[model samples]
Target: MKRTTVIGFLGSTLDASKQDAARWNKWRPTVGLCMQPDLRVDRLVLLHGRQHEGLAKFVTQDIASVSPETAVEPHTINFDDAWDFEEVYTELLDFAERFEFEPETEDYLVHITTGTHVAQICLFLLTEARFIPGKLLQTQPKRGKPDAGGVWTVIDLDLSRYDSIAKRFAEGSRTSTSFLKGGIETRNAAFNAMIDEIEQVATRSSAPLLLMGPTGAGKSLLARRIYELKAEQHRLSGAFVEVNCATLKGDNAMSALFGHRKGAFTGAVAERAGLLRSADKGMLFLDEIGELGLDEQAMILRAVEDKRFLPVGSDKEVESDFQLIAGTNRDLVRAVAGGSFREDLFARLNLWTFNLPGLAERREDIEPNLDFELKRFAAAEDTRVTFNKEARARYLSFATSAEARWDGNFRDLSASITRMATLSPDGRIDRPAVEAEIVRLGNLWAVEPEQGTDALAEVLNADAIARIDPFDRKQLSEVIVACRRNPSLSATGRELFSVSRQQRTSTNDADRLRKYLARFDLTWSDVS
Candidate 1:
């Protein structure tokens, strides 16, 4: 076993008594600490003032008389006022820094039973921080036994050593992470990990956070959720103010963000309390922050760093202590390099940046988000809507397929669900609704062919092209061009048969295109 060392202050009143054999009956805490039956204190480091040098020597002798094997070392630490927390803490900190600690060779314990309350608190802090590398040794006078040694208990600040407490903390962390995700059981591993980190930063820090992602990637929703979570925790009092930086421009931008005086500019309207001021003691989410002008960016940087800014046409600075959460789909680093964005402002907001992936990137989570959207619609519209087994399966299959571009991300998914839910007969969606939605989504995603290659020239020789009639050749050429432009045969057919497709109730664009290709002795692989 490693030798034990106990460090504590010399109790002026408790330790000091008549220097005689009769004093043995009175329980001196410092002396009683060494005399504990179970605890074997190898060395005692007693801290005292220069004025208590004689008393220190007497206590050392008293401890030595009973425990001859224990070594007592006195350290002369002086505080002008023992009750002054700063002075006492500083002196104790200096002693802790100067002392040599060897955890492998010696077990160190900080004795908190014999010192000013402030001094004890400082010692506990130092020990907890591992500056002294020790556990806390607290000794109390044994009840109904004045002459007997005190009972001692050791408190280790390393929380991981306690299984129950560590498990509780882990559970709380998971709950907080789930709350940050808006209680959505998101299945994307990368997204879940990002949410976990965001949860920690959101709860522990008041610093500005930067959320970067593509449009409709749920950046605004996440920002609102963060505000709500903080509000629920009682960390924020004022309302959550959100603004799209893309909408603010020119003189109006300044007046909108920083508030305007009664006679600020062209409008000369009444005084306005800007989004920042309105968000005082709360959160301000600046969505599409990359759209703000350089001047606005500079002003925002000042407000973020100093929490004070001059409003439009105002000389004095107004304070708005608000936490900032900036959202952007733009590549800010490139913007900074291109001189469109301020680097200093980027640095300020970059402290806690999180990139949320688009819905396409997290296709596995689409099912859960689909369920969440349906529930949301039901709650908002006051009518429950659900998909039949076949309809739900078909929708999910199409949703997770590569053909579903989902370029608009979560917004597209939410809209699709909302449309189907509204169209559902008696709150139950069936196969017809799913098929109609698929066709609608397909039409919505299709785009006109771009000007490029002549597919007929690439596939057929000069003589073969000459044998065909101009009309048939021209139609075949158009079909081939669409095939080359689109990703799949179905997509190509959709583009080629777009005009004629609306006339037929059940049209197969892919089959139509295949027959047209066969007439020209060509396949999709030939031109595309």
Candidate 2:
């Protein structure tokens, strides 16, 4: 029975704009259908609060309306309707402790949402409970209009992979209260050492921080986390402004960051404050700072370095006092070398720098992240959860194992976690789920959209190997997938390698091709 795959549906009492309701609607049936071989025995249970009995019935009936055999039965736990946050949490914890005790095989898949206070309590406690591992899914409810679509965040639970990020976050949980608020799990020694520097900058009287890391390495989150911690100290309630330079391309972009004077331009019918003004004495997070044009960078550099800015069509420099935090995925040093970025601007912004570690580098944070994820999943389901020891060990073993290079960092960790959590049965994760995820990951890396192997082609076209940055297991798998998709050498070269735009420019293409192929130590025949 411990080996059977089981899928469980969990939802909260608070249904926001019914978007959470709709997400769970899509999640359950899709998982059930995706859970190949239904005859394996255990029943699929959809857990919801007694208050949401009607909503629960609706979700299941809706799923059944489309697929009758996969209808999820509503499982209501014992809890009082009128309970305080603590009481609700305690009750949910009690339920979560007994989650895996159901008389069925240990494998389990649990789906949920971030709502009820009880949900937060129960699932937060699930991390401490070592039961069988399973899939953990969470949906954040959005409010406003009913018909508009809401956002959902999903992660498969594999604690072993995220050990580095999880451990740091856990350590941070003692001092910072927003543990539940999303963060990059950068506990790797590289980031552990770097975070201390970042913290110092946050505490410094006027030290500006420039966050340098790969794309989606939680730079923005870390910046916001620093602001949240410091804002409370000053007793100043200011807003946090996030500016993605890569996204800013035109006049609308100009006005969006720096304010425009009234009748400043054709569209300037009225005076409007930009994100900088809105941030006032708050924190301004500039993401992808390297992507900014020299002109925009010059504008921001003046404002941040000197605390003054000139509005559009106006010569008067506005005095703006705000904490400036910058994040970039591009290499600023290289940008400086290429003359794409200003050395003076880089020097000014280099008051404080924090380099965040990618997910693969930090093996320690994975388990804690896994536990945190489970707690999240449990809370969303309004159910308490636990990870079986065997599944937990298997999940963690991958961390210290030889084959892993987490190129995407925390982003990849979240993806792997979501896959593992949703595939577990009876709330207990099994080995099969882990293996299945590896295969899925392998397939993901095997190919690009219209090319064969980026790595393999890079190798054959170029003389040197192109080592993948933030190397880890997941991305390596994807490289393999790319190789599988494109089998021929000429295709690898002409299609993947020959990307240069110059006369007989196979030199550039061949260089890229060689670097990619060298990562896997393969030649043209490897794909063939």
lDDT of 1 by residue, 397-443 (tens): 99988678775789989999999999985999899999999998898
TM-scores, all models, native as reference:
0.76, 0.51
Off by over 4 Å in 2: 1-187, 379-385, 399-402, 423-425, 448-528
Q: Lowest lDDT 10-mer window, candidate 1?
A: 447-456
lDDT of 2 by residue, 356-461 (tens): 6555545677776777767777777665545577767876786444344444566666677666766664776677777776667656644334332443342233
What shift in Å separates residue 190 of candidate 2 from its native position after superposition?
3.8
Model 1 regions more than 4 Å off = 1-3, 9-23, 42-61, 67-105, 114-126, 230-239, 260-273, 447-528
Error of 1 at 202 (Å): 2.6
Give the distance in Å from residue 80's predicted Cα in candidate 1 to where it truly belongs: 7.7
